[model samples]
Target: MNFYTVLEYIGMFLVFVGALFLFLGALGIFRLPDVYNRLQAGTKATTLGAFGAIIGIGLMRPEWLPKAILIAVFILMTNPISSHALARASYRRGIKLWDRSVVDRYGPYLREKEEKEGKR
Candidate 1:
């Protein structure tokens, strides 16, 4: 097979893999017990899924490579950061963790910081 044809096959495979992960992410978001867990599932899965899909599309269309790379970079940068900000906000807003959650690391750290700063 020619190189471009090989790339097309690889791109198609990646697109399918990406779609599968995206579907799984949606399922996790729907089925998870709490917002924190759902956010964790959605953020991590979709970041990789979208990056793969964008790069796959770029491979299929050589002219789109630069734009796809930029979009992938943006997703990689923003998804996790936004997920973190949302989780922290939810925790500060008095959202409770899932009943089975084992540790409370952030709560203790925040309390220490607040106590040191003398702020509520």
Candidate 2:
């Protein structure tokens, strides 16, 4: 096979892998028991899946690689922070968590904020 053809095959393979990850994430979003778990599904898996697809496209289209990489990097930087913000907001608003949830890391933080506000 030619060089471009080989790259195209690899790109297609990566696209398939990405699609699989996206599907898994979607399934998890539906199947998960809590907002935190759903957010985890949406943020991490979807970001990786999207990044994989973009990287695949970049592999197939060398000239577009820079833009693809930038998009992936932007997503990597923002997705987790956004998820964390949403989780914190939900926690603050008293959203119910899964019965199986083991820990509440943000609880102490919120309590501290409440105490500080009360003192103020």
Segments of candidate 1 deviating more than 4 angstroms: none
lDDT of 2 by residue, 14-105 (tens): 88898889898899899988998899898888998998998899989988989999998998899899999999899879997898888877
Candidate 1 lDDT by residue in tens digits, 8-109: 988899888999899989999999999999998999889889999999999999889999999999999999999999998999998999999998898889
Residue 12 error, candidate 2, Å: 0.8
TM-score of each: 0.91, 0.89
Clashing pairs in 2: none
lDDT of 2 at 40: 88
User: What does each candidate score in C-alpha RMSD?
Assistant: 1.7, 1.5
Error of 1 at 18 (Å): 0.6
Q: Cα deviation in Å at residue 40, candidate 2? A: 1.1
Per-residue error for 27 in candidate 2, Å, reads 0.6
Candidate that scores best on TM-score: 1
lDDT scores of the candidates, listed in order: 0.92, 0.89
